[model samples]
Target: MPERKPRADALRNRESVLAAADALFARCDSPESVTMADIAAAAGVGKATLFRGFGDRTGLIHALFEMRLAPIRLAAEEGPPPLGPATPPHRRIPALLDAVLCFKIDNRHLALALEGTGGGSPYAAEHYERWHSTLQEALEHLPGPADSAFTAHALLAATRADLVEHLLGQQRMTRDQLRSDLKAYTARVLGSPASVD
Candidate 1:
């Protein structure tokens, strides 16, 4: 059997569909609000083609979230070197928080879409759990007592979706402020000698 290449026009249509979905998903209250018709109209494609490109609306949202989160995953995995005894806790801890804050700010819409409403799917839970574990691993390497795990959990809660949303929407704090405060609080919880005050 030979690999079949997609037709040039099909490729273009797929790109158009993805672009439309990205734009609509950002503004829609829920992923369900982004109908196939809306996407087809936005992309200048027929409804049938939209379905052909992305099976269903959930599939489209999944692809959109995956596309937006790829860079974040890479940054979390490789952006800052893992915390270690040789690494200063103040420096490495702040870097980790900054990385997550940046990711949340950059992908706010996609993250909201995935985990905001509709009771949230299993995918969102899995994503959050993975992040929690990654953060715990970083905290484990910090020069702290055996109870660093609890401290890590507390820090993660402070940097969670609800906190970020409140900081941005209600408190009107700049993204930099949230990132700074999170890092500062995390340092305090970890007992880092460098104080932000």
Candidate 2:
């Protein structure tokens, strides 16, 4: 049988749950501190409703993270300049890296939670694969021979959530400084000082 589409109320409840979860993550010092019960209460839904909507805590976190990432993902997939298909390789690569870094920084708690979901290596995640392929394809367009696959992985490693948190939260590196540093480092890898942006 075909899966039934969610009713209007179910859709509203799902949105409420996600919004509540997002707010809790933003306010909490630790992601584990925010319980499913708390999210249900905040959303004015029952625990069963939460589970029905997202299956489990990890599922909920993944859904919320994806919801937040939708805009940037759309931009990278189809939007204009530096993030879209129309942009030049040299400009697009750094723009892509910068977007990943900014996303991690802005969504630190949620990203951290997603990373700790016991789902194993983050390298296995669908989002990671998509970002990696995009970066790799762009790297292939550079002037000389280079291992685009490995280069993409290396660039993404620099923007991992834990590293971003350590630099921003523990080490107290400002956002602009980190971005500039990443831009510079990426330039070195691409073998073009002019590409730093």
Candidate 3:
């Protein structure tokens, strides 16, 4: 059977909920503090509407995160240099990590909310698996004894939302400092000279 398109009202409600949630997450001190009720109220929808549109808080977070991450994913899969597959793996790997770091930093609250959604192993996340494999593939292409799988995990660890928040909030490290440190750290791992640019 052909699936029915979502009613216009349904689509509008979805957009409203997502926009409200995004704004709340962007400004909130803590992701956990933003509740479904808060989102519903912010969107001017009922609690039932929020629940009906999204299964739960986690579902809403996942949808919002996916929307935010789509561009980076597209760039990695098919876009131009630095992030695209056409870029050499050595450069692509660094670029991927840099993008990931910036994404988590820019969307810190949303990222943290997604990360803290459940007690399940974070490795189980679909996004985690996709990025892990992307990093692992690039790492494998480089000539080295680096355990690509472990290296991928370690590289990703540097961009964790919690770590980014800690360093930026309490450690007082500027974004440039973090980027430079990450670039230098990646260079040491890959046995390449760090580029000043």
The worst-scoring run of ten residues by lDDT in candidate 2 lies at 188-197
Candidate 2 lDDT over 18-124, as tens digits, reads 99999999989987899999999999999999888899999999899899999999999999997997898889999999999999999999988887875777786
* Best TM-score among the predictions, by candidate number: 3
Clashes of 3: 0
Where does model 3 exceed 4 Å of error?
A: 118-120
lDDT of model 2 at position 87: 95
Q: Over all chains combined, what TM-score does candidate 3 have?
A: 0.96
Model 1, C-alpha of 30: deviation from truth (Å): 7.0
Q: In model 2, what is the error at residue 130, expressed in angstroms?
A: 1.0
Best by lDDT: 3
Q: Could you tell me how far off, in angstroms, the CA of residue 123 lies in candidate 1 after the best superposition? A: 8.2
Candidate lDDT scores, in order, read 0.68, 0.90, 0.91
What C-alpha root-mean-square deviation, in Å, does candidate 3 show against the real structure?
1.1
lDDT at 118, model 1 = 31
lDDT of 1 by residue, 39-77 (tens): 899999999997787887666666776677676676666
TM-score of each: 0.71, 0.94, 0.96
Give the distance in Å from residue 41's predicted Cα in candidate 3 to where it truly belongs: 0.3
lDDT of 3: 0.91
